[model samples]
Target: MQRGKPLPQKEVAQRMEVSERWYRNLESNAGAPLTPEALIRLSTALALGPDERLALYRHVHANTKLGEPEPDGPEEARSALTHLLATHERYPAYIVDHAWNMLDCTDPMADWFPWVREPEANLLRWALTAPEAREQLTDWPRHAALYLAQLRFALVSSRDNRQLGALLDEVLADPECRRLWDEETKVVAYRQGHRFRLRLPHVSAREITVTSQVLLPAHRQELRYVLLLPESDPAPLPNRGERDPAQCRS
Candidate 1:
């Protein structure tokens, strides 16, 4: 479909570089499974984002790989990810699931962004709706827009995810968030190589610049590790137990 209107089957077949009959059979769910190449072509023809592309792969996987292992439960995933977070003790690190729900964080992350310790902490919700976010994140508009863009990207593949749908509804209630959601069309799913200034009241009065890098566990692609690495050129701040910041930027 192009926007809200449905593209003709012939047009879709043409875009996929496939015969109209073949596309119709695929659409009717009455043909052999698509090859990886065909799937890629279909995804491209539909203009799917990363999440949607993954969704397409999973759909094929479900039909073919009945012996695949089940996903790790929340508690199991949290325990494993705790060790992962500890490994990055020098940086601000945290784990989030597909819905951007905070599962765990390094002590340094909690110190710098205590909101992660909140009940049922969700990254997109706080970033988009919380008043504290504006105070802590410099260039709030850009940051909020990025968060919203990620959510919009997720929406493509997470249409059936109740948590994601609820989170979207809650954030869109805010006037500013609603405006951003309506106006932002970009689809950025990760924060790789994104540097932003942050103010941590418990850390230092001065704003610190940090580049956010997102990583995925090899086994659990649904979980993401968001690590905030302080630009190394600046003099780092002193650590004071769990109350101190992890890194500093001048």
Candidate 2:
């Protein structure tokens, strides 16, 4: 309902080159489910971002008890996050579940860490035990320590969730993880504007800012989105070179 314009029904019909009556029915949620074409038209008319557009489609036809079940599986959640991440090509974006598991990543992420293609990789594990973690992180100890602290916070906040709790135990069972967790230190509270600089396998160390947002009741698992952006534009970094940075640090 944009101001100074005809009703949404009329405007939508004109934009889609369809009958005003049909558009009215659709707008009123009385028409049949939207076809892909109709959905695209509506999305365009509304200037919807990928996530917003997907939400709109889901809203129109979703059958969940509530709108919370659209991303029920890892793949569905990945797809949703991927769509949003695709919107930012220059930046690296990723989605992590409540357990701090890295669920999905964008191309820029792969460019920074090629072995991210492995079946399932946890950012927490990599940050703590991977040698590449040490090499890539400009301030290895500090970043690793901060990451552990964040994971601890997430664990405490979601203690009642069996799955999340299990993940915490599994990660902590690793000797290195245990040592880090044993340290009775806590960092500042998690905030979105924090930034860090890290060196990648073949890439020169570059500064990157981290931004995070909570996707409420996300994907039935309280998943969150964490995006990484350049602190300032740096020359593009290499993807992979002589080292396999994915291996665990000895």
Candidate 3:
């Protein structure tokens, strides 16, 4: 209301189709009850930008439903990944929800990353809990910190998620993970590449550098693809000749 050449409250109230007294009440109390739709109108009338709009959502929807990035259904997310899986056949890739659960993956991803194929698997949970991870990731401790930091960031947007809460419970139970989280370091979401050293399914132990990235689908912000691209041609690549049918399925 008082940004620039202040517009009259009466006219503002009239434009919003609300009584001036009600508008005054809203202006006075920041905690006033507001539906999501009403907040949109209010944000726009105030000429709030995208960030301000989110701030409004964070405030108004604090105890109720989340504001934006409304997710596509899990099944729909799964169906969408089939196309993505086939497209990224040369690289290891898997899709995950905000909760970090693996919704789908390319065959090479399932072959190379054992955790992705496991049922009820979450990327964060797997990294922090899997015994194999300690040996697989050359930089386990640092990567763990980054992954946990990312989880903490996601929680701000999804305070009411039961599954995330349960996941938090399980994470807090782990002494090492809890300690790192307790430190409250500003690690944020994992976005960069990492060097991995692991014993393969059939091949000899291998060390490879792979970068991982998250891709949000056009229609759904929650459904994201975590892709691992090799930094360079891996030594003695999977199969010197034709790729294995079982390992590189489309």
Candidate 4:
């Protein structure tokens, strides 16, 4: 179960067909070496989040050192971001640095990209250059402008940093980006609790809310966590003409 879920031990015991005490021991790390079969049962029983499940596995089996240092350079950052992308399989998650450079993403992101499998894909590039992405976005121009503004705000705030300045320069060099940059636009920090619609491929248009929570004191840059949550439980699309195609398209 996820960290704050209630009565996880009881739930695990019921699912595993084991007594509550035995299940509690496993969760509490009292069991010295959880057998492979036992671990699988625990993982399923607990319905653990990816991070939680991985933490449990590492604790019992890998003998790996816990919590490597925060990734310092681009390579290390990419490696860390890739792990996060892989872990959040069900949800589409992407990582951006202080300057809002898209670092890594998951397979579900492919719903917005024809080149989903490409290495080193950047969100800005996709938003501005990719025709598929443009079509997928309900309000492409507004979304593109908002992100560019966010990037500009980040650049202004972190101008002294060499890496960030270089990224800004690279983005500005693009013709479409250059055109947008020339517009005298004001950057309004996205208000908390703002939600919007996104047209994801193969899925009917869904409302996704954006929440900005901050992680701070990690050196010169502040890390912002952008969560994309479905506004409602998405109804599955009918395979063919079972439903009105026009309504579903909207």
Candidate 5:
């Protein structure tokens, strides 16, 4: 059902290119599972944002279970995520698929974690393999184990999945990741979160509270949004609002 505004089943059906009755059946959840193509069409018609589209897909997925592994997020999902990330000006934020590949990130993220801007960047891989990570992350052992456990959970649906399997192989080849993979036997469910401190180069050491959050689509749960919130608001500096007199010469 259209939650708000003037949108009706007939209008939505026309947008989705389906008959009114068919759209009503979908609204009522009386129809069969919508194909991927149908989901895309419906998503477009419903004008769903990233989170809403994800919620819609999750509703569909509950009944279907894990039928197929989604390697990447759809264009709609990507746009929604990108739009949301763009809103974070001061803090670092990014989106990664289930396999940990960086989909997109805020500009500040590049300043904080430069490695994330690289092409085909993967969160788990970089965190485990990057030399700079050792300096950035103050508590590596705990975070690394959790990262490994999350990857293990991802591997469950991807045993035979070629792309994800290849990613697993690559991360497993790394010495640190391999050790954590073998040592961390427990599965850290999505709800449970962790925190870590990051000290960026040339910047003061600030404590960051990090957490992994999920945005699941109907096809499968793949996307995870990572946010870095400061442990506490920084103290206001003296002359905070006053501009430098030298800088006013321009």
Candidate 6:
């Protein structure tokens, strides 16, 4: 918990433009729940990283009273998220809502996976049901299992969400997807720095490896900015007898 500096509670409260007592109450979890804007300001004041920020939101949301209504899903991609996808034009980048539905994507991303332009496009559904996905992804089964696991995780958190329930039903309609969903018990909350391989003959004759980096917008945490950063060709492995010095005991 390396907060930026050892500032006093009063200083931290001043940075967030709140009263010292209110800030202290927030620290003790005795005050009213902070709004999203206030939470963002608090995170900034504390210099929380992406993981910590998400954890903070989850903790607060989990503690929300029974009568409190959950935030509605955004109808369209926020401008900030749209701009983020646009700016990352060189690599494949896209925005997905909490339900894993594709909201917007870059031209390169659309060119690579054209399904994003389809009406009500969903990344999980496409990855699980589309035949092309098997050909495009180097390790289809592993990725498919991962997508199903992530969907399972979402379903638990958003049990009342009609769209997510519908998405689950649609994917389960596929025999293979249903099998994977039932068999894969693993659950994934996020894909912060997941690395996977893609076979894009249109881009290159050989397979390409890209690491997925997830970014959460300050205002719209529900929307995830997924950027696929391409990795350079890996170095050749050494001969079997040539032991690496790093692996040897001192």
lDDT at residue 79 of model 1 (Cα atoms): 70
**Model 1 Cα lDDT, one tens digit per residue, 120-157:** 88888888888989988999999998888777666654
Q: Which pairs in model 3 have colliding backbones?
A: none
TM-score of each: 0.74, 0.55, 0.64, 0.48, 0.59, 0.64
lDDT tens digits, residues 81-152, model 4? 466556656555555556554545554444434353455555556666667766666677777676676555
Question: Which residue pairs in candidate 5 collide?
Answer: 57-218
Candidate 3 per-residue lDDT, tens place, 43-64, comes to: 7777765544564565455566
- Worst ten-residue run, lDDT, model 5? 241-250
After superposition, the stretches of candidate 6 with alpha carbons farther than 4 Å from their true spots are: 1-77, 233-250
Query: What's the true lDDT of residue 152 in model 1?
Result: 67
Q: Give the alpha-carbon lDDT of every model.
A: 0.76, 0.62, 0.67, 0.55, 0.64, 0.74
Task: Compare the candidates by lDDT and give the number of the best one.
Answer: 1
Following a full C-alpha superposition, what root-mean-square deviation does model 6 have from the true structure?
14.3
Could you say which candidate leads in TM-score? 1
Residue range 47-99, candidate 2, lDDT tens digits: 55544454455455545355443655766665666677668656666676665
Stretches > 4 Å off in candidate 4: 1-88, 99-101, 110-116, 160-179, 188-194, 205-225, 240-250
- Superior by TM-score: candidate 3 or candidate 4: 3
Question: What TM-score does structure 5 among the candidates reach?
Answer: 0.59
User: Which runs of model 3 end up more than 4 angstroms from their true locations?
Assistant: 1-77, 185-205, 237-250
The lDDT, on a scale of 0 to 1, for candidate 6 is 0.74
Better of 5 and 6 by TM-score: 6
lDDT of 5 by residue, 115-159 (tens): 776667877778777777777787777767766665655555344
Q: TM-score of the candidate numbered 2? A: 0.55
Candidate 3 overall lDDT versus native: 0.67
1-250: candidate 6 lDDT, tens digit per residue? 2443467999889999999999999889796469999999988987866655655666567534445444443544466677666577777788888888787787667756767778878888889888989999888989988788677666655556799898889989999888897775555678878999888665565778889998876545668888988897433334424332111000
Q: Rank the candidates by lDDT, best first.
A: 1, 6, 3, 5, 2, 4
Better of 4 and 6 by TM-score: 6
Ten contiguous residues minimizing lDDT sum, candidate 1: 241-250
